[model samples]
Target: MQSDNPEDQKSTEGMVDYNRNSAAQQQIIDSQAMQIRGLVEKVSNIGTEFRIVDYGCGPGISTINVMRPAIEACRSAHPGEKIAACHADQPGNDWNTLFGLVSGPSGYLNGTENVRTEAAIGSFYKQMAAENSVSLGTCFAASHWFSRALHLYAPNTVWFADLEGEARAEMAAFARQDWLTFLRCRALELHPGGYLLVSTLGSVPDAQEKNGFAASGRGIYRALQVVAREMADEGLINGEILDNFVFSLWFMSEDEARDPLKQDPELSKAFEIDTLKVEPAPLHQADLFADSIGDPVEYARLYTGYVRAFADSTLRKQLFEPSTNSAEDADRLADEFFHRLDGLYRKFLDKYAFEIWHLTVVLRRR
Candidate 1:
């Protein structure tokens, strides 16, 4: 069920060119393609039709890429079974671009017979399809998002890892609840023998790091904080707004991701863990920075675009838009903010890096 609170209704839909700018996310998906295919190959007892749902499938080629291997494996494993590629995301998602890609040259539908596409428009934290219907479910780079926009005050930082004291504890508790809700919803949608593959941003324990933890996107969030503070200092936004601003997402550690399944009797009885692991994710744009001989100008443009793609909508609604009355004022401030962020990236190219990690897990319904 959707939240009634307006703040909670804030959408995390990516910018229009999400596919082009989300190369790092694409890399995470690509790294696990073999594993996805392997799991599908092992799937048995599928009915006359095979249904594979991509939950939180943002608009892009990433979803297409993820579905291809599984589609092929399904075909090889269960010949003559019709295939259904179901894509699920928030209602505000760019469905046009998604469908465009689905019918485009690179889509799984290309030259493939006995296959059809579907769209399930709603939160993945709720049941997306009928019970015992989904054969294989996959969610990539999106499960970290909270079902609602949290109103918690995170005065020190814009990222969860830097949140301190009560803020941190509250965020962790909320994350745990959201994770279990997601698992329960998936349990309802999947068949008894269905397979679920999820890969999202994650964290790891590090004694040398602050809070004794290190997480993906830390540098990016720090850069965001610095740039937002600069804007606030210039009177573009108020101090209170800056202090309260925090991304409504969490990057869970490996143990945090596994705890519920290990501790909850219901989850333990509902599903069996096939694989759970965390690995460092490569930043494709960073590699391009190296190839460009550390060209700050080009690097900054690329990195800023990458960040803006996923974050622009949220920042606009939660920060910039709320700070001003006139739409034009909000637009101007947003443009200026990105401009300054780009300049900061250029000025401190070496200091800011998207050092990200990914948690990949495969679970089978019991």
Candidate 2:
């Protein structure tokens, strides 16, 4: 179900679509595998039962692939130490898909006779785990999502990655609050020597100077706006409704990502920052298709499908339903909107380069 609260949009946006484009996600997960294993081992050395929480686990792809293996390896080394792994997310998450993945023969829990895995569904902003319980907490490509959408301003745009002035400030404030809440919750849940590793979507340095989506190739979001306007002009959707549609996703910069932890003396005193770095994100579309790369038309289909899976629900909510416009009619119009968007992306692909920014941080609970 779609949420009246825009924050749930993160869950409602579709994780299955994200799982389909698992190449880039898997790349990042694999890159961090060694670090995760080290942390798990460090906790296991305490000679106590260990717990791992994959917060906002999505479809559990990363948990099953990267985290489960790391935890299981730690369990094996510790012999009889109990290792419990929890996949946490909002209840609206696609739990069926997650269950299917974790229950199959190839599932993370399948071969690990000594490890136990369970689903813990809830917002991480609250106490998802018992106080001072979790040994290692891993939240990848998930913390950028705020607890609630900043409702102060709605621009004629979809993502906060391309806003300025008061709009940007409002989003920054929300991100800061969300970040603090995230840290506080984790601090309370983590044992004295536990570790917390977080990853998020980010922008390049001086991102604000060139607009927040500087690394994303400005044309990507512009194409979305153009298609929306054209759909309104064609009587497919309400002009007012289309004009009001805005996505709640906010990609904080490196400084913004760190400010909350640095400024809060209490938070800073509780957790020691181990490492914070911004790096180039893996561009799966470009990397995977490099050898067999085709013309703009073919690439557009692949790109749009990847984007559509995540963005279509956000757009669908704004579609008006009048007597003349049934849900079926709206669906058809939505399809047309994406079709035109694909064409626009194809036309602009050659003129601009695609780039993505990523941020990774490691913290130790004091």
Candidate 3:
């Protein structure tokens, strides 16, 4: 059942048609296929049933990609074991779309025998499955989101990495706690010797950047800030809304991702970190920009659509809805906001290119 509370409702709304615009996520998953297969092959015990759970599986397009390797490996390692592939995400995610894709010809279940699929609706920060039930757990291109929208306001910036002073510290603390919660939840769901593979947006050190750290999607956030401020100045929206608006997400640095396990004894005992590394993720739009050298209009449209897919819901709820009185007015403002954002990308094609970095981690439940 859906929550009646507004905050709960807002927290549940996930990316809009995430599968259609998730090429970057697909790239990240494709790159990790070898690692995923290797990890799955290392599982020691063969049980009667093999369960693979995908946490934060938005729309199920990339979920299938992330799970296919594990499915194949598990089948090869322990043939004829009943396999269950489960996708978990927020309640308000595009479930219809996810289910449609899962049943389609291209889905992981299409050609596989003795395999079943299931959905668990809720936060990944909480357990979504029975204890010791999951053989493998995977989260890709998600988990950067906070458990809930933080009440703290960031007046100067629209993204976590750009926040400074107290605001940044507060956000970091919340992120650390959320990460531990996620690990603990997975620890409970995954059986002993089960594997958890995670790949999400991450931060890396850069002396030249602000806050002495560089994160993925910074350019996109920068563009959003610029367009939002422009709208505020033009009286399209209130300056106060812009001041209070910040994406409820955080990209953890390598140190941030590791600190909880290093500091918390319980977490340390729950899972042993097999691999944790940060590497640059491919920006699919950049390739398109290079290919469409003379067609900035097409490139801008594609890039803006990708941004809108993941960001439109947040902007609508947090920025436009509160800035306006009625739903109609909010919709109008959201349209105008994206229109301006698209125009900004068209004019400065090179400025908003995404430079994403991903932190890939493999953990074994102990």
Candidate 4:
């Protein structure tokens, strides 16, 4: 499957073809922020000193934010107690950003030891000091992005490229690997009876739901394929549709989480998903998406609003424009693309209404 791996914000080449401000991301953060607090309350290591690993704690904002409440609650329930919180992210993750998240304690939290923060890349997966020592573990919306062994290429490479099929395949595989890795690691990291709290953006199955969850992947890909063909016909972009480009995402499940990850022999029996529970994480801030937004036109408007909210309008346009030489031009182009995208979304909304699922899975390590 084709993959466009953007490692964090800046690459070695110093290209910035991405947007930093993300409202959907912020919405996700806000939604999960509270349940994470509740997960902290469920943990009680009465006599033992506490240690935790926020598995796949991307960039550390979620981990540190969750940790803050946990630390305070721990103190309140067991007054004058010294608790230690460990924020874990892959070594390849952005540490500087994680550092910034934890540096500010803001008097609401005090008396908790930082417990020697460590970055765990793949090698860190080998072993850790927390051998069955962790009291609580949470992978908030980040487990499904892990690398896996079941890397299979779909049959139709040409069709895949023409339709950005590779991207879909990659995201699907990513979804699988993330669940497997999270459960497998949960088995190894948590002590018996400890809980693993996981939350993620999940795909709903029905055509209407799917069209709703990812309306743009297909429409946008169609447009790009046409553009690629046109450019190639005119002696530009080498007319290569098979180049690296794809669309994919793993979505919500009511039952799959009950038995999601494929059972691999390499995974220890002890490190299995002993019990799984899934429920929809409802959206509270309707104002973020409009209270009564259902019309085809309104859906398109909301969809485009979402894209523009997440992306810098200017950078997206640069992909097609010859004069897109500077960052300003790129932003302008992105804006235009999103402006036109409202029309594209209208096409999808006319056919199907989407159901975006926020999934929370509770895994008990075997």
**Each candidate: how many clashes?**
0, 1, 0, 19
What TM value does model 1 have? 0.95
lDDT of 1 at 71: 92
State model 1's lDDT.
0.84
Give the winner by lDDT.
1
The TM-score of predicted model 2 comes to 0.87
Per-candidate TM-score against the hidden true structure: 0.95, 0.87, 0.94, 0.61
TM-score of 4: 0.61
Look at candidate 1 and give me any clashing residue pairs.
none
Name the better of 1 and 3 by TM-score.
1
lDDT of 4: 0.47
Query: Of the candidates shown, which would achieve the greatest TM-score relative to the real structure?
Result: 1
lDDT of each: 0.84, 0.69, 0.82, 0.47
lDDT minimum window of 10 residues, candidate 1: 284-293
Per-residue accuracy of model 2 over 159-213 as CA lDDT, tens digit each: 5666667876777777788888999999998998888988765666664554634
The list of candidate 4 runs beyond 4 A from truth reads 1-22, 44-48, 78-81, 105-129, 148-178, 207-244, 247-249, 260-281, 284-288, 291-355
In model 2, the runs with Cα more than 4 Å from the true position are: 1-13, 44-48, 152-156, 211-219, 282-293, 318-326, 350-353
Q: In candidate 1, what are the lDDT values of residues 128-215, reduced to their tens digit?
A: 9888888899999999999888767887788889988999899899999999999999988888888999899888898987788888
Model 3, 1-366: lDDT tens per residue?
Answer: 222354563543767667767777888888889888888778756466888898988887788787788889888887778888899988887888888888798888787788889999888887899999988889987888878766567777798988988888988888889899999899888888889998988889999887999888888899999988888899877788678778888888889899988899888999899988887765543343456546889878877888888888888777787788788998999889889888988898868878778898889988
Where is model 3 more than 4 Å wrong at Cα?
A: 1-14, 282-290
